[model samples]
Target: MNEITLPPVSEIDWSTWVPEQVATLMFILRNDEVLLIRKKRGLGAGKINGPGGRIEGDETPEECAIRETNEELLINPINTRFGGELFFHAEDMPRIHVHIYVATDFEGTPSETDEAIPIWFKLDQLPFDEMWDDDRIWLGHVLQGGTVEGYFTFIEERLIDQQVIFN
Candidate 1:
């Protein structure tokens, strides 16, 4: 048998550790309206969300945000800024770490795509009832021009426990 030595636990920077799948979300907002999409397929199908998707190899979160926006909305997202991070854990699914960004500068009008249908709503008129369980709890903060960090736990699409903080 061979023996291996490991570094002290304190030497590890666990705070920066990331799970297998990394995702990015970008929200485009104007004075009183924010653009959203009705997802047609994939996780949270039929739910309303900002355009986003899994990050590909070697792609930065910001890069992933731009790519996802273009793919889903056919628009070029500009002046994007990192807004927050979300940690989601589900009993039957892999944990997901999402990097969220807010973009107010963009070109072209949004249109429906194979993945989702573009929609706009007055900020105060957002349809929280038709979004992911955690959205109603935390998304409002993001819409209010604040940063948010959330650790959410879910069981089969139902939120079990969550702690959301806004800056």
Candidate 2:
């Protein structure tokens, strides 16, 4: 038997090392509003984002997205479509990648849950200023029907440089 040796902490770029599998709901509300949440934990906790969570167990990312939305905001993600993936890399965390999604429809009214507070925002009223800085750079591009995969270098939680491959 062989033991798998993990990389030394000193070799891991903690500043940019954040590998995550995340699903984001693009729940379009009745009045051209988008359902968003104030996350309670993780990378974007306390900032506005769509309902989602890390992929767990044998569940696929799509399943995780729907389950997370239900668990976090008590909403049923209906007519959900796989919007595709987002791959991000940073120099601080050189060995991890992020997978992101955008879903289209959902059921039930948005409400606050222990993990998040769901709210509806008009299409033009997105609160980009209160979110992670990288969001403003790519989130809009994703919502606008573009596919994205990129690498970024961050220092002290601030992005210093990025390279995106959009399709």
Candidate 3:
């Protein structure tokens, strides 16, 4: 596999790097179905994941989550709660801090956008095999009303080590 080519971890100043390419991801759940997207372009394209993207300057993670949702899925996520955080340490990609959220509801119907195709799956039927490897680390916990925080390091897309906490 071709590696993502991120800056070396040792050079990353995590204390101040949270503003660098910070991202937000939102999962909207209803009944037993969870909304996901099959990205059509950019990072993680062709993979199954929730709707989200980079945080613009002066925008909070929550704002980014709502904005990305409206852009990608044409819905305004409602009752979004901060779920956890993911710190990415990878060789191929730059260090990233991603804020995660779970939306108990949303406004408008999900429609496909230029960036992704929205899809839904049963809570017990998530496509783990088609998502980022780290999804297996915290997805289930947050989906079940629990919270999660994960720090994952990778080399060439292969998981190197992981630390996760759930409550």
Which one wins on TM-score?
A: 3
Q: Each model's TM-score, in the order given? A: 0.87, 0.73, 0.88
Better of 2 and 3 by TM-score: 3
Q: How does each model score on lDDT?
A: 0.84, 0.65, 0.87
Q: Which of the numbered candidates is closest to the native, going by highest lDDT? A: 3
Any residue pairs clashing in model 1, and if so which?
none
* TM-score of candidate 2 on Cα atoms, chains taken together: 0.73
In candidate 3, clashing pairs total 5
Local error of candidate 3 at 13, Å? 9.2
The global Cα lDDT (0 to 1) of model 1 is 0.84
What candidate 3 gets wrong by more than 4 Å, as runs, is: 1-19
List, residue by residue over 19-125, the lDDT tens digit for candidate 2. 65444444434455677888887666788877776677888777777888889888777766555454444434333355566656667776788789877777777
* Residue 99 displacement (Å), model 3: 0.4
Q: C-alpha displacement of 159 in model 1, angstroms?
A: 0.7
Candidate 3 C-alpha lDDT tens digits along 33-100: 99999999987889999999999989999999999999999999999898999888875666678999
Could you give the candidate ranking by TM-score, starting with the highest? 3, 1, 2
